[model samples]
Target: MIDFGFTLSKSSTVDLNKIDHSRYDQLVKLVPTARMCMNCGSCGATCTVSEYKGMSVRKVLYGIQRGEDVKAMLSSCMLCGKCTMVCPRGINTRNLILNLCKLYD
Candidate 1:
């Protein structure tokens, strides 16, 4: 058996650092759905792209909180709207992701 470890390159590290927590304010500022994510995996659970592209919808917000670049998840989104429908808070994840895409991409 071989144990393989993961290595994040220098550029990736830079992207992680590029996350500015201040952007979260925009979520509350521009959209009411922004602050609604309760860190529930429901968004991640319902995300269509997660299975294919390895994007964690919940982590994107968390990453943003930690000042990490979640911009990667912005484009991989499938825009299925399932997350929004399933959300207990009724957060419009589809729209939130779209707005985040503007900043991510």
Candidate 2:
């Protein structure tokens, strides 16, 4: 058997039905604005931490929905409120981030 230069990468598929969503549901209840996000890059673009640390509010929100641990990512957030100012949906992103952090505590 001949080996190819590279083998197939591990599956990146996420089985939404199998992943736990209780945490995300709780977040939405605490911060209703969590549901208003449209995954627009605006929040990430305006994030101060994102400029150097690659911290993205959009990814963090998605991570919560996927049941992935995002505490470390959330820690990088400076709560500067730039994301809140730029959100087209008018979501209070600072409040949402605060609430998301509280969900773990």
Candidate 3:
């Protein structure tokens, strides 16, 4: 039997606590939507793509605002508009992702 774990012991030469919140710090605050979401899992649950890669149309946008690389989400959307219809907020999720696509480019 062999234990294999890559571990770094404490040392003055290594500064493990590197601060890196620049992504979130540089993002513009998302304007609060007038249409309140009921927190229904309908969008996440019924999402056709979720079965493949597990995406929430709502959470992806939130993650983008906080400056996450949400590219993994792009592939999952079928653009079939199921999420838009189910959204109580009437937010155009597909359009949001379409616009978000430009950022990655």
Report lDDT per candidate: 0.73, 0.85, 0.61
Off by over 4 Å in 2: 1-10
Error of 2 at 73 (Å): 1.5
Q: Which candidate order results from sorting by lDDT in descending order?
A: 2, 1, 3
Model 3 lDDT-worst window of ten: 26-35
Task: Evaluate residue 28 in candidate 2 and report its C-alpha lDDT on the 0 to 100 scale.
Answer: 85
TM-score against native, each model: 0.73, 0.84, 0.60
How well is each residue in 1-105 modelled by candidate 2, as lDDT tens digits?
589788889876898787889988998888888888899889998889886667777888888888877888788988999998999998888888888878786
Instruction: Report the poorest 10 consecutive residues by lDDT, candidate 2.
Output: 50-59
- Predicted candidate 1: what Cα RMSD to the true structure? 4.6
Q: How big is the positional error of residue 45 in model 1, measured in Å on the Cα after superposition? A: 1.1
Q: Comparing candidate 2 with candidate 3, which one achieves the higher TM-score? A: 2
Task: List, residue by residue over 1-105, the lDDT tens digit for candidate 1.
Answer: 455686555653535455566678776676677677788788778777888766766787777766776666776787888887888888777777777777643
lDDT of 1 at 4: 69
In candidate 1 the C-alpha lDDT for residue 6 amounts to 67
Q: How far is candidate 2 from the true structure (C-alpha RMSD, Å)?
A: 2.9
Cα-based lDDT at residue 60, candidate 2:
86
| Per-prediction backbone clash count | 0, 0, 0
Better of 2 and 3 by lDDT: 2
**Weakest lDDT window of 10 consecutive positions for candidate 1:** 8-17
Per-candidate RMSD, Å = 4.6, 2.9, 7.7
Q: Which clashing pairs does model 2 show? A: none
